[model samples]
Target chain A: GGIITQTPKFLIGQEGQKLTLKCQQNFNHDTMYWYRQDSGKGLRLIYYSITENDLQKGDLSEGYDASREKKSSFSLTVTSAQKNEMAVFLCASSRTGQDTQYFGPGTRLLVL
Target chain B: QQQVRQSPQSLTVWEGETAILNCSYEDSTFNYFPWYQQFPGEGPALLISIRSVSDKKEDGRFTIFFNKREKKLSLHITDSQPGDSATYFCAASLSNYNVLYFGSGTKLTVEP
Candidate 1:
C-alpha cells in the first residue's frame, strides 16, 4: 500500500504570476503525470514522466512545465497564471505498462 | 479534438434504482478503457475498467459494458446510494502508450 501526497491544497496567485505545485508518491511507480481539471471538463493531461528526468507533453502542456526530480517526486509549474483562472491540478502515478493510476488529493488553484 | 466523449452530462436517480452512464471514443487504436470517480475537492480514482477484448467487467455494484465494434462503453450502477453521487470520467488509452484521453465526465446525483 502507498499514498500520493500533494502540497498546499489551496493556491491563490495573481495574474501572470508563476506558481509551482509539488507531488510525492511512495508507490515507487515509474510513471508520473500532471493533469488539469476544469469545471465540467474532466481531467486533461498536462505532462507526464516515464522515468526520472523524462518528460512528455500532452495536449494541454502549452503553459505548463513539469519536472521529475526523482522517481518519487514530480512538480508542475505554471509559467504565467491567467486572470480568473480556476482549476484543480492533479498528480497521479502508475507502474509502467499498468492501467491503474493512483492520484493525490489535488491542488486547487485560483488566479485573481 | 476530443478523443473521448460522455453522454448525459448530468443524471439524477433515486435510491434503489439504477444509474447508467454512456461513453464513446473516436480512436480505434485505444484498447484500454478506465472509469474514474471523483468527489468534490478531490482527485479522480479508478472505479472500474474494461479492455477492448472483454465485453463486460464488474466490481461489486459497478459494472462496465463494452462494445468494441461501436467504440462505446457504459457504466451501470445498481442500487444507487447517496454516497455514489460523484463525477464519473471515461478514459481511453492504448495498451502500449501510457497517455490517457479522458471524457468531459458525467455528474451523477443519487437522491436518497
Candidate 2:
C-alpha cells in the first residue's frame, strides 16, 4: 500500500509571510486536492488538480494558491499569513470522479 | 447560506450506546454524499458514502441513511466506543465534479 506524505507536520509562520506546503502521493492517482480544516468547521476545498499542471479554485480559494507540478505531487501556498490563523491543511487523492478519497496525515499551520 | 449542515455540533454518549450524526444539504444537485472521520491532528478519511439512488448503505458497524427527496443523510455508529471519539464531516457533491462541500462537523465523544 502507498501513502500520501505531507511535509512539515507542524508549521509556524509570521504574519504576512509566504508559506508553502508540499504533498507527495505514491498511489499515482490522477486527481489531487488541497483542503483547509478549521476547528469545528469541516474540510473546505482550497484548490484541486485533476492532473499535472492543472489547477482549479474551490469555494475557499481566496488567499491560497495550489499547483500540480507533477502527477504525483501537489503543493499549496498561503499568499499572506494572518496572525492567529490556524488550520489543518489536508491533501487527498482519488482514483476517479466521485470515488473514495485517500488522505494524507495533514499539516497543521499556525500563523504568529 | 451554509451549503451543508450537520446537527448536534458535539455529542457525548456512553460506551455501547448508539451515536447518530445528522446532515442536511441545501444543494439539490448533490448526487453523492460521503461521511469522513477525522481524529485530532489528522486528516479526514472517507468512512462511508452513498449515492442518491440508494436509500441506505451499511458497512460493518457504520451505516449511512440517505434520503434523496429530503436532501438529507445521516451516519449511525452502533455500539459506540471511546475510540470512536473524533470529528465527523458530511460532504456533498455532484458526480461529475470532484469538489465536495462539507458541513461544519460533529464532534463525538464516547465515554466509558
**Which of the numbered candidates is closest to the native, going by highest lDDT?**
1
lDDT tens per residue, model 1, A1-112:
9999998899999999999999999999999999999988989999999999999999999999999999999999999999999999999999987989899999999999
Those runs of model 1 whose alpha carbons end farther than 4 Å from true positions after fitting are none
lDDT of 2 by residue, B1-112 (tens): 7899999999999999999999999989888898999887778888999999899999988999998888889999999989999999999888758888899999999999
The numbered model that scores best in TM-score is 1
Evaluated on chain B only, what are the TM-scores of all the candidate structures, in order?
0.98, 0.97
Docking class of 1: high
Query: In model 1, which residue pairs have backbone atoms overlapping below 3 Å?
Result: none
DockQ of each: 0.80, 0.73
Query: lDDT of all the models against the reference?
Result: 0.95, 0.91
The alpha-carbon deviation from the true structure for residue B111 of candidate 1, after best TM-score superposition, in angstroms, is: 0.8
The residue-level lDDT of candidate 1 at B16 comes to 88
Those runs of model 2 whose alpha carbons end farther than 4 Å from true positions after fitting are none
